[model samples]
Target chain A: MHMDFSFSYYIGLAGIMVFAISGAIAALEHKEHHHDVFSVFFTGFITAIGGGTLRDITLGNYPVSWVKDENILWAIFLGFLLVIFFPKLLTKLRNELFLFDTLGIGIYTVLGTRIALDHGVNFFASALLGMISAIFGGVIRDTLMNEVPFIFRKEIYATACLAGAILYLILNSFSTNGNMNLVVSASVVVLIRIVAVRYNLGLPKIKIF
Target chain B: MHMDFSFSYYIGLAGIMVFAISGAIAALEHKEHHHDVFSVFFTGFITAIGGGTLRDITLGNYPVSWVKDENILWAIFLGFLLVIFFPKLLTKLRNELFLFDTLGIGIYTVLGTRIALDHGVNFFASALLGMISAIFGGVIRDTLMNEVPFIFRKEIYATACLAGAILYLILNSFSTNGNMNLVVSASVVVLIRIVAVRYNLGLPKIKIF
Candidate 1:
């Protein structure tokens, strides 16, 4: 079944850039320990693509995400180069990181759900995939930084993505407008995240017994 | 499609303990940064169980590995308690980390292959699963620590796991006793790893331009 590739591609690319910038900003905090620009760049690249790659492989796709598209590599490299060459500019604009990351999560969630649906997976599984795609990279980033994953910590991370995926499926079942559904689903996630952050809302903590 | 549960449980338990210890040792180097023993223990728990959990979940096994047996959780907790109480002892024994990690790769690789085969997956897929099961936790740990994965960097990590899995399959085809085949295959991996570490042997890097 052929689908509209361009729409998802643009959304996915936007997600990558946002993830890259957030990763770079996170790495900047560790600048006191002698982190090179390359390290930050690579971290961003991994954060942007890591989760999606894992999702794709688990779904049994060959050549993986980064391998199949030269654009991904170029985007990552350019993202890093820009951050490296313009550290002051990036630092000043660091406040925008959360906004971009939230938007990225929204886009990635929709794209992941769409891909899973295309693969003939069930709705619940597609939603799961969507959340995984959206949050896995950030989880990887947090873990690498020796911190617990953001999803497992503060912020409405994976939950927002999951809600968005469910919304996407619900919209798709009732309507023939895929693009509108994607946008609506993504907007749902972005709005939820923004409100959650603004209100300091979060999931209940797991008790260790 | 019922399988023997007794052997699987013991093997899986041993695998968790081994992986947990390796995680503990890896976390020790970061103690100077105020990373407490509890953090170390949690890291160990995730490292030990993460791979198997991912393997089972992706393979469509509900309830996951640690969820099926509460012992896994207790084991990780006990493992952490021991490390916390005997910090100096563990510090003194740091040299054994590589040996323990190598043994972990062997056991997990064999166990993963066996489980995949039991599920009626083909040899190639089973071997791939084995490789994923063995290396993925470490990969996750490295990513969390902001280090490039060991499998992606120095040494033939995943390749050794692949070799062990293939050998297990070969021996099974030859009508070897199951326990004996596991031992032989594990031995092959352990020996390869020991030699690789001693000789600084590694896979040739893939240069992407």
Candidate 2:
């Protein structure tokens, strides 16, 4: 059995916490007067794990990480409770949301790519898996919240993930150390996303009709 | 490896067709002032396979149902094209939609329950898996359309799937013939759902604070 307190696992737990915070913020935005704790927690938990669950499934990895790892589940609940008690801790909601989402995609993309490679997927498919892992949680969260997925919006969100994932794969092929590859690839995603949001930049719209 | 052609596979393909039609109908409902073919096809295809895909993932079934089965992909496309070319074929949209959805859940619940059992899940989890396979496709469809999932509404929808799933398991425990169990269990789901929708029946509401 793998050690429970691995540094890698802790980093993944931190990513889950970040995603749960964003999910809770969304739930808070869409709260009905009749909403309860279950609704909030379920949304947050699902958002925290949706992407990785999908990635593992796609790669035929068994036991999906959260099922065997109770700490991961705890991290999501902790994140939700943090939001519930200190909503003001996430003041500047829009900016903080963007930051959290960027961190989430950055971390997940690199991690997902590595896992997919370990599962023996081709480089291209692994990169695609990375992008899927990074963005699908938000896609699911928006769907549950009755909104068109944020990924479908006019933003550089998914593109940033795709770029970073591909970059990670390319860097791996260059014999760079794994730590350097992860840091550089994830930072590229974060920097691109930050700049895009700052300048309201996006891909050019096409009139395909 | 499973055969290229099987009675069971054909039945699943038919269910895919039913789900895709409903998804296409929803896409048609929500068409923008300017939208394209890709959007419609994607929405329809996703709806057709969404439930089964999730079911297999949860069971840790490999390659998923649609991924390795080219014919399954073809079935979804056929369903989408049918709707695209002849929207009028599904006139009286409400009744037809109910019929299609009811038929879909009936077929999928039994099949999914059996698949989950084969994957060694306990009885309760198998029943839950059956309901998941029956409902999640529509759940995904509604989400993608930026609506609250239909199953979350006041309805007998998920309950019908659950009852049928439990019935199938009970019958299987009695050493009932496989075909007999499949037919009877699926018919119960269809009959109950049809009656519920006809009479506007739903589970009683509880106001949880």
Residue A58 error, candidate 2, Å: 3.3
Worst 10 residues of 1 chain B by lDDT: B30-39
Instruction: Tell me the tens digit of each residue's lDDT in model 2 across B1-209.
Output: 24336555566677788898887777667733112454455567778888988998787787677655567667888887777666676664757666766877897899999989888899999999999998898888887877788899857989999999999999999975987898899889999998887899998899999
Residue B3, candidate 2: C-alpha displacement in angstroms? 7.6
Clashing pairs in 1: A143-B144, A144-B143, A144-B144, A144-B145, A144-B146
lDDT tens digits, residues B100-122, model 1?
66777887888888888888899
What are the runs in model 2 whose C-alpha is more than 4 Å off? Answer: A1-53, A62-134, A141-146, A152-209, B1-4, B31-36, B92-97, B144-146, B204-209
lDDT string, candidate 1, A172-195, tens digits = 999999989999999999999999
Model 2 DockQ reads 0.15
Q: Let me know the TM-score candidate 2 reaches against the reference structure.
A: 0.60
| Local accuracy by lDDT, each model | 0.74, 0.79
TM-score of 1: 0.58
